[model samples]
Target chain A: MIGTFVVARRELSGLFMAPFTWIVLLVVLFINGLLFSSFLYQTQGNVTATLSESMTGPSFWLWMIFLPALLSMRLVAEESRSGTLEYLLTAPVSDAAVVLGKFLAATGFLALLWSSSLIYAVTLDYAGGPPDWPAVIGTWFGTILVSGLFVSIGMLASTSTSTPLLAAFLSMVSCLMWIAIPFLAANIMAYLVPLLTSTAAEQAVLAERMGSVVASMDALRHFSRSFQMGVLDTAEIVFFLTWISFFLFLTARSIEARRWRG
Target chain B: MIEVANLTRRYGALLAVDDLSFEIGRGEVVGFLGPNGAGKTTTIRILAGYLAATKAGRLVVAGHDVQRDSMGVRRSIGYLPESVPLYPELRVEEMMRFQGRLHRMDRQAMRVRIPEVLERVGVQDRGKQLVGTLSRGLKQRVGLAVALLPDPEVLILDEPTSGLDPIQRGEVRDLIHSLADDRTVLLSSHILAEVESVAPRVIILHEGQKVADGKPAELAASLGGGGHVAVEVMGAASAEDMSSLIGSLPGVESVATGERVGIHQSFEVRGEGDLREDIGALAMTQSWALRELSWQRPTLEQLFTRLVTGRGLDELAMPVASGPGAAPSSKPEAGPAGLSADAPVLASGLELSQGPTGPSALPLGTPGNAGSKIIYSLNPFDRGASRDLSKPVSVDAPPEAPAEGLPDGASEETES
Candidate 1:
C-alpha cells in the first residue's frame, strides 16, 4: 500500500510541475468560463436549469471525451519511453500498485478540474439566484463518475504503448467509441427489425428487447436521467464502478505482461 | 549472495543468455567482463529481478528465489541499470526520498541516510539541483546514490562508468572499491581497466556463455604459454648455452635473447607458467650467478582477446567451471567443454611478436621500476613450478559454495 502512495505522490507532483499542465488548466478554465456565460445568457439567468444543461449538454460531453486523454497520456507511456519504468518496476513494488497509483493520480486531477468550476456556482448565488443544492451536488458527483470512467480507459491505453502521443490518440478514439456505440446500436436495431419482421407485433417485441439493451448500456442516459435530476440511483453507481474496476484490472495485467514480453 | 543455474533467456529464437551459471559469495566483488551483445546486461537484469528468465532456469539472490519471491529479491539487491535511468523532473533529494519510501524506509531514517548516500557518491552539493539539470556525470552519481539509499546486501551495477570521462570513471571505480567491503558486488563492464582495478575475480562471457572464471593473473597464465619469465644471469657460459639450458625446462616452450651486457645476459623464456623458480633452481645447481629472476605476467587485455575469440577456451588449462554440466570433477589437465564447433573464431592467429610483448615486457628490478608501475599481484600458479598447482584446489571446491574457504591468496598478496 505504501508503494501505491509513493508512486501516486510522485506522479501527482510531476503533473503539477509541468508547464504544459498549467497551460491546459488555464485554457480549459477560460473556455469553461465562456461556456458558463453562454448558458446564463441562453437561460435568462436561471442558474439551476443552466447547471443541469451545462452538466448534461453536448459541449460538456466533448470536454469529457478529450480531457482524460490529455491528463493520462504520460502516466505510463512517458515512463516507459524515458526508461524510468525499468527503475520503477525493479523497485520492491508490485505491478498493481504502479498501475493503480497512476490511475488514482489522473482521477484526482480530474476531480480538481471539476472543482474549479464551483466559482460559477458562487456567481449564481450572488446574482440573486441560487442553484438547487441537491441538483448541484448530484451534477458534480455524476461528472466525476463519468471522468473516472474515461480516465481508467485512458490508463489502459497508456499501458499498451510507450509513445505518449500515440497513447493520447488511442485514448481519445476509445472514449469516443464508448459514448457513441450504444446509441448507434439502438438506432440500427430499430431500423433493421422493422424490415426483417413480417408482423408489426413481432417487430414491436424485438424493438422493446433492443431498447432495454441500449438503455442498459447508454451511460449518458443514466447520467442525465438520475444525476441531473437531483436523484442518486444505486443501479447507475454500480454500473460505473464495475466498468472502472474492469478497466483498472486490465491495466494492471498489461503492466505485468510487459516483463514477459521483454 | 547470488546463484544462477542453467539460466537461459530467448527473445523469439535469439538466445540472449545460453545456459549460463555462476555463483558469487558474500563480500566478494566479481566482475562480469564481456563485449557488447554478450548478454551481460540480460544476465544482470535476471539477477536483479527486473526481467524474467525462461521457466527452466532458477536464480536465487540473498536467499530468496527470484521467480518465486521477486519482491524479496528486489529489496535485498540494489541495481543500477546500463542506462542509469532516473526521473529528470525530480530534484536529487526528492529522488532519494522517493526511492527510500519504495524501499519501505521510515522518514526519519531517510532524512539521515539521504545526505549520507549523496556524500558517499560525491554528489552532496547537488541535492537541491534538479535531476534533469545536472550533467551526465552528476546524474550518474545521483543514480548511484538512489541505488545506495536502501543499503542493500547485494549491489548489481551494469556499465557504471560507460559514458563518463576518464577522471569520472576513476572516481566511480574508487567509490565502488570503498563500498565493496562486507557487501557482495557484481559489476559488469566492457572496459578491461575498470574491472582490473576493482574486482579481484572475473567472469568472462562470450556470445552469451561462460568462457572463463578466475583471477586476472590466473586467466592470463592460461593463455597457452603466452607468459614470459625474464632472467639475467652472470656466468662463464655463453648466452646460447644458458638459453638452451633454460629452454630444456619441463614447461618451457621457447626462449628469446634480450639485452646482453658483457658477461651478464638477459633471456625471455616463454612457457606454460612462471619459469622463474625453475630457472633459479637450475642456476643454483649449475653454479651460475642468478642476478635477476622476474615473472612477467600477461595483461588482462591479452586474456580477454583470446577468450572472446573462442580460441583460448580450447587451450585454457585452468579448471574453472565453464558449462552448466561441469562438476567439481578435479580434472586439472583436461580443457573446459565451453567451446562449440560453430563458434565464429579466427583459428589462433596470434603470432608471438618478439619485441613488443606488451607492458609485461618492462624489465623489473631496474631503477624506479618498483612503485612507478603497477605490478598486479603475482599469479598463484606462478609460485609453484607449473600451471596446475592452483587448479586442483579450484576444481575440487564446490562451485556453488560460499566464500569461506575460497582462494584469497592473490588478492591478499596484492594488498600487502
Candidate 2:
C-alpha cells in the first residue's frame, strides 16, 4: 500500500510538471465550458436537461475517450523509453502495485479535470435556478466510472509498447473500437444475420439475443438511460468496475512478462 | 552475499548467459569482466532481481533466494545500471524521498538518511535542482545517491565510470573503493585499469561462460612469462646490431625496436624474468649510453587479451609498425597520432580478422582465438565484437566522420 502511494505521488507530480498537461487542461476546459454554456442557453436554463446533455453528450464523450489516453500514455511508455522502468521494477514494489498506482493517478487526474464542471453547478445556483442535485450527482458518478474504464484501457496500451506516441495512438484506437463495436454489432445482427437464417422466427430470436448482449456492453447507453436521469443501477456500476479490473490485471501481467522475455 | 549456479538465460535460440556459477562472500568486492555480449549485464540484472534466469539453479543474494524471495533480494541490494536512468522532472531530494518510501523507510529515518546519502555521493548542494537540469556527471552522482538510500548490504554497479571524464572517473573509482570496504560489491567494467585498481578478485566471462576467476596478479602470473623490459640506448652500432645484442642476452625471448631519436633507439625486450640488469650489464660492457631501462609488470589488459583471444601480448610483440611483413589492413594510413602509436592495438585487430582455425592447435575450451570468432558468430547483436573490430579503424578514420556518421547525428549537431 505504501509502495502504491509512493508511485502514485511521483506519477502525479510528473503529470503536473509536464507542459503538455497544462495545455491539455486549458484546451479541454475551455472547450467543455463553451459546450456547457451553449447547451444551457439552447435549453433555456433547464438545469436537468442541460446537465444530462452536457455530461453524456457526444462532444464530451469524445473528450473522455481521448483524454485518458493522453493522460496515461506517459505513465509507462515514457518510463520504459527512458530506461527508468528497470529501476522502478527492481525496487521492492510488486508489478501489481506499480500498475495500480499508475492507474489510480491517471484516473484521479481525469476526475480532477472533470471537477471543473462543478462551476456549472455554481452557475446554476447563481442564476436564480438551482440545479437538480440528484441528477447532477448521478451524472458525475457515471462520468467517473466511464473515465476510469478508459484510463485502465489506456494504461494497458501504455504497458504494451515503449513509444509514448504509439501507446497514445493504440489506446485511442482501442477506445474508438470500444464504443463503435456495439453499434457495428447491432447492425450486423439486424441486417447480416437475416441473410443466413431462412425462418423469420429464428432470425427474431437471434437478433433479440444479440441486441441484449450489445446493449449491455454499450457504456453510453448505460449512462444515458439511468445515471443521466438520476437512476443508479448496481449492475451498471459493476459492469464498468469489472472491465477496469480486467484491463488492469492484463497490464500487470504484461509488466511481469518483460522479466522472462528479457 | 551473492551466489549463482548454472544460471542460464536465453533469448529465442541465443543464450545471453550460459551455464555460469560463482559466489561472493560477505564484505568481498568482486570485479566482473567480459567483452561485449559476454553476459556481464545479464548476470548483474539477474542478481539484482530485475531479470529471471531460465534455469535458476540455487541463485541467492543476501541470504534470500532470488526466485523465491525477489523482494527481499531487491530490498537488500542496491543497483546502478550502466545508463543511469532518473526522472528528469523530479528534484534530487524528491527522488531520494521517493526511493526511501519504496524501501518502506519511515519519515524519521528518511529525514536523516536522505541527506546522509546525498552528502556521501557529493551532490549535497544539488538537492533542490531538477535531475534533468544537472549535467551528466551530477546525474550519475544522484543515481549513486539513490542506490545508497537503502544502505543495502550488496551493491551491484555496472560501468559506474563509463561516461565520466578522467578526473571524475578517478573520483568514482575512489568512491567505489571506499564503498567496498565493508559491503559485498559486484562491479562490472570494461576499463581494466579501474577493475585492477579496485577489485582484488576478478571473474572474466567469455561468450557467456566463465573463462578466468582469480586475483589480478595471480591471473597475470599464471600466463608464465615476465612482462616486457623497455630499454633506450645510444650506441655506436647500428639499430639492427644493437637489437641483435639485446636479443642474444641469456633470458631475453625477443626484442622489438621502438622510436628512434637521433642516435638513441628504444627496444622492448621480453624475457623469462627481469632483463633490465642483463641488458644494463651488456650496455656497460659495450660502452653504450643507457638512456632508460625499466621492467614493466604484466597488466590486467594483457591477461584479458590472453584469456579472451588465446593470444598473449608476447605473440603480439613483433615490430608490426616497422616490419615489412605487417598486414596491409593493420596499417591506418590516415589516423590520429595517438592511435598510430598503439602498436599492440593494431596487432590485436590483425589477430581478430584471422578467423577460426581447423582442428589442430588447441581444444575448444582453451583461450584460443578461435573461441572469440565462434562466439561472435553466435550472437549477431554482440556489440563488443563489432566495437572491437571497428574501434581501431574508426579511430584511424577522421575523428569527425564517426561523430557525423552516428545514428544520433541530429543530436550531435544540435549539441555542437
Candidate 3:
C-alpha cells in the first residue's frame, strides 16, 4: 500500500509538471468558455436568468463531451509511449492500485476544469437575481457523474493502445457510441410497425430492451426533474457509479494482460 | 552474493543465453569477458531481474529467489546496462532521488545517501545539470551513481568503461576497486586490459558458454602452457645470433627477438620449464655479456586469444629461426639498423606484384598469389596478418619511400 501511494504521488506530480496537461487544460477551458458564453448571448440574457436552467441543457452536454477528450488523452497513452508503464508495472504495487491512482488523478483534473465554470454561476447570481441553487447543484452532480464515466472509459482506451492520439480518438468514439446508440435505436423503433418490431424483438430480447430503456432514459430530463428539483435518485447515481466501476475493471484487466505479453 | 544456475533465456528461436551458471561470493569482483554477441548482456539482464528466463533456473540474489521474490532481489542488487537508461528531463539530483524513492528509501536516508553516492562517483558538481547535457563519460558516472543509491549488496555492470576517455576509465576503474571493501561487483567487458585492471577473477564466455574461469594470472599461465621469460643481453653476438642460441637452448620452446645493436639484444623466451640456468650457461660459454634476464608472466591478451581461437600458445609462437636445414650459416647479414632479426621476413618463394608504394615492398595479397592461398588455409591469425600487412607494391619508386624496403613502419607505429 505504501509503495502504491509513493508511485501514485510521483506519477500524479509528473502529470502536473508535464506540458501536455497545461496545453490540454488551456485549450479545453478556452473552448468550453467560448461555447458557453456564446450560448448565453444567443439566448438574449434569458439563459443566465437562473443557474439551474443555464447549467442543464445541450450547453452542459457539450462540456461533458469535450472535457473527456482533453483530460483522458494522456492517462494511459503517455505512460506506454514513454516506456514508463514498464517501470510502473515492475514496481511493488498491485495493478488495481496503479489503475485507480491514475484514474483518480485524471478525474481530479477534470473536476478542477469543471469547477472553473463557477465564475459563470457567480455571474448569474449577480446579474440575473438570486440563482436557483438546487438546480445548479443538481446539474453539477450530473456533470461529475458523467466525467467519472468518461475518466474510466478513457483509461480503458489508453490501456488498449500506445498512441495518445489513438487513445483519445477511441475514447471519444466509445463515449459517443454510449450516448448516441440509445437515441438512434429509439428513433428507429419509433418508425417501425408493431408487427415488424415484434419479430426482431423475438430474435434479440436484450437488444430490444436496451433500445427501449435507452430511449426512455432521458438523461437531461432526469437531470432537471430529480437533480435540479433537489430530488436525489438512487437508481441514477447507482447507474453512473456502476459504469465507472465497469470501465475501471476493464482497465485493470488490460494492465494485467500487459505483464504477460510484454 | 549472487548465484545463477542453468539460467536460459530465449528470444523466439535464438538462444540469447544457454544454460549459463556462475556464482559471486561476498566482496568478490568478477569480470565477465566475451566477444560481441556472446551473451554477456543477456546474462547480466537476467541477474538484474530486468528480464525473466524463458526456461527458468535457480537464480538466487542475496538469499532470495529471483523469480519468487524479485522485489527483494531488486532491493539487494544494482544493475548498470551497456547503455544506461536515464530520464533526460530530470536533473541528476532529481533522478537520484526518484530512483532512491522507487527502492523504498525513507526521506532521511535519501537525503543523506544521494549526495554520498554522487560524491563517490565524483559527479557532485554535475548534480544540477540534466543527464542529457553531460558528456558520455559523465553520464556513465551518473549511471554508476544511480546504481549505488540503494547501497545494494551486489552490483552488476555491463561494459562499464566503454566510451570513456583514458582518465575517466582510470577513475571508474579506481572507484570500482575502492568499492571492493564492502560490495560484490560483477562487471562484464570485451576489453582485456579493463578486466585485468579491475577483476582478479575472470569468467570468459564464448558463443553462450563459459569457456574459461579463474584468476587472471592462473588462466594466462595455464593457457600459454607456462609463464613467459624476458631475456635482455649485452653481448658481442648480434640479436639474431642471441635469439638463435636461445631457441636452441634446452627448455626454451620458442624465441621472439626485439631491437638489437652490436651487443644489445632483447627477446622473449617461452617454455614449460625454466631456462634461466641453461641460458646463463650458454652466455658464459660464448662470453656474451648478459645485461638483463627476468622471468615474464603471460598477459591477459595471450590467455584470451588462446581460449577464443582454441589454439595452443606454443603453436602460435612466431618462428624466430627455421629448422636446421633452412638456418642461414653464421646468420644472414642483419637487415637495416632498427630491424629485429626475428621480425617478419619479407622475401619468400612467392612472386611479388608492383603498384604505388605506401610504406614497404610487401605485396598486397593478389587473388592468385600462392602466399595468400596458403594463408587462408593455415590459420585465422594468418588471415588477420594478411589484412594488416597486405599492400600493393610500387613499380615506380617514390622519393619518400624508406631505404632497404623493410616492413618497419607498422612495428615503429605500434611502439610509438
Candidate 4:
C-alpha cells in the first residue's frame, strides 16, 4: 500500500512536468468555460438558476470519456514504452501496488480536472439561489465513480500494449464498449425478439416484464435522472464500483501477463 | 552473495537461458562475457528479479528465492538494465531520489544520501541536468548512481560500458573497481579490455550455456593453447639456428622468428615450461647474446574466440580500426613482437601492423625506427627491440597496397 502511494506521488509530480497535461487542462478549461458563458447567455445572464444542470450535463460526461482517456493512456503505456516498467515492477512492490498506484494517479488527475467544476458550484452558492447543492454533491460523486470506471478501462487498455497510441486507441475503444455495449445488446434483443415486446393479456405482461428487465440493465437508468437529480442512489454507485474493479482486475492480470515475454 | 542451480528461462519454444548455475562470494566482481544472444542479459535479468525463472530451476539471490521472494531479492539487488531506461524528464537527482524512495528510503535518509551517491558516481555536478540531455557516458554514470542508491548488497549491471568511448569506459571501469570493496557486482560487457581491467574472475556464456569460468588469465592460459615467450637471439648463425636453439628446450612448442636482422633475430618460443632460463643457458654455452626473455600470457580474446567459435586468435585479432588484414592504425606491427603474431612480412625488412601490444621483444627494436614499429604493452618495462642499432630493420613505407587502388583509398579514408 505504501508502494502504491509512493508511485502515485511520483507519477503525479511527473504529470505536473508534462506539457500535455497542461495542454489538456488549458483546452478543457477553455471549452468548459465557453460552455458556461454560453449557458449564461442562453439564460439571459441568469447565473443563479442554470448552475447545477450545466455542471452535470452532457459536457460533464464528455469530460468523463475524453479527458480521462488522455490521462490514463500514459499510466501503463508510457512506463512500458520507456522500459521503466521493469524498474517499477522489479522494485520491492507488488503488481497490484504498481497498477493501483498508476490507476489512482490517473484518477487523481481526473479529480483535479473535475475540481474546476467546483467553481460553478461556488457560483451557484454565491448567486443567492436555493441551489440543488445535494444533487450537485451526489452527481459529483457519481461523476467520479463514472470517471474511475472509464479510467480503469483506459489503464486496462494501456496495460495490454506497449505503444501509447495503441493504448490510447484501446482505451477509447474500451470506454465506448463499456458505455454502449449493454444498451446495444438490449436494443438488438428488443429488435430480434419482437415477442419480447408487450402484446395482450398474460403473455404480453411477461414479454413486457422481460423487456423491462433487459432495458433496466442499460447504464442510462442509473444516471439519467436519479443521478442527475442528485438522488444518491446506492445502485449506481455499486455499478460503478463493480465495473471499476472488473477493469482493474483485468489490468492487473495484463501486467502479470507481460512477465511471460522478454 | 548469489547462487543458482539449474536455472533456466524459456521464451516459449526458445531457451533464453539454459540450465545454468554459478556462484559469487561476497564482495566479488564477476564479468559476464559472451557473444550476442548468449544469455548474459537474460541471466542478469533473472537474478535482478526483472524476469522469473522457469519452474524447473532454482535461483537464490542474496539468500532469497528469486521466484518465491522476489521482493526481498529486489530489495537487496540494484539492477541496471542493458538499455538503461530512465525517465528523460527527470533530473539526475530527481531520478535518484525517486529510486531511493522506491527502495523505501526515508525522507531524511534520501535527502542526505542522494547528493552523496551522485558525487560518488562522479555525476554530482550534473545532478540538475535532465537525464535526456546528458551524454551517454553521463547517463551511464547516473545509471550507476541509481544502482548505487540504497547501497544494495548486490549490483547487477548489463553492458555497463557497452557504447561509451575508451576514456568513458575507463571511468566506468574505475567506478566498478571502487564498488568491489563492499558490494558484489555482476557486470556484462563486450569490451574485453574493460572486463580484463575490472574482473579477475569471469563467466563466459556461449549460446545460453556456461562455457568457461575462473580467473580470466588462467582461463586464457589453459584454453588459450601454450603461452608464448619473447626471446631475442644474437650471435646465432641464422633464423633456423635460433629456432632450433629454443625449440629443443622442454615444453617448447614452436619457434616463430620476429624481424630477421642478419646474425640476430627475435623468436616467439611457444610452449609450456619456463624455457627462458634454459635458452639463456644454451646462449651462454653457445656464446650468443640472449638479450631479452619474457613470457606473454595468451589474451582472453583468443580463449573466448576459440571456445565460442573455434576460430584462431590471429584471425579474431583483426585490427580494431579495420577489418582483418587492414590495420586500424598505420603504425608498423613488425620489429617488436607483432600484435598479429603472423602479420605479413614487408619488402627489404618486414613491417608489422600494430594490433594488440604483443609481449616485449627487446634490444631488437631500435629507437630511430619508431616509424617502422611502435610496441605498447601493459608492461612499462617493455624494452624496445634489442637496442643493437647495427642491423636496423628498414623503416620503409607501408606494405605494398593491393594492386587495386581500394586498399590505398581505405587507408586514406581511415586517415581522414
Top-lDDT structure, candidate number: 2
Model 2, B1-416: lDDT tens digits are 89899989997799999999999999999999988789999999988888888897789999999999999999999999888989999999999998999999999999999999999889999999999999888888899999989999999998888889988888888888888987999999888998898899999998899998999888877773556888887655545677888889998888876654333557888878888899999999987888899987778887788788898566554333343112222222111112322221222122123222222233445444243332242322122232123222221112222211233333223222
For every candidate, the chain B TM-score is 0.64, 0.73, 0.71, 0.71
Poorly placed runs, candidate 3 (over 4 Å): A46-104, A122-201, A204-262, B224-244, B255-269, B273-416
The Cα RMSD of model 2 versus the native structure comes to: 15.6
Q: Could you say which candidate leads in TM-score? A: 2
Worst 10 residues of 1 chain A by lDDT: A114-123
lDDT of 1 by residue, B125-164 (tens): 9899999999878888888899989999999999999999
Candidate 4: misplaced stretches above 4 Å?
Answer: A44-49, A190-220, B230-245, B249-251, B256-268, B273-294, B312-416
Report the candidate with higher TM-score, 1 versus 3: 1
**Between the candidate structures 2 and 3, which one is better when assessed by DockQ?**
2
Sorted into a CAPRI-style docking class, model 3 comes out as: acceptable
Residues A116-152 of candidate 3: C-alpha lDDT, one tens digit per residue: 5566777767775455566566667776777888878
User: For each candidate, what TM-score against the reference?
Assistant: 0.76, 0.83, 0.68, 0.79
**What lDDT does candidate 1 reach at residue B170?**
89
Ranking by DockQ: 4, 1, 2, 3
Model 2 ranges with Cα > 4 A deviation:
A190-198, B234-272, B317-416
Model 1, which residues run further than 4 Å from truth?
A186-211, B223-226, B229-252, B255-269, B272-296, B312-416
Docking band of candidate 4: medium
Displacement of residue A195 (Cα, Å) in model 3 is 18
Q: Which is the better candidate, 2 or 3, if ranked by lDDT?
A: 2
| Per-residue lDDT of model 2, residues A9-35, tens digit only | 889999899898899999988988899
Model 4, position B145, has a per-residue lDDT of 90
Model 3's alpha-carbon lDDT is 0.69
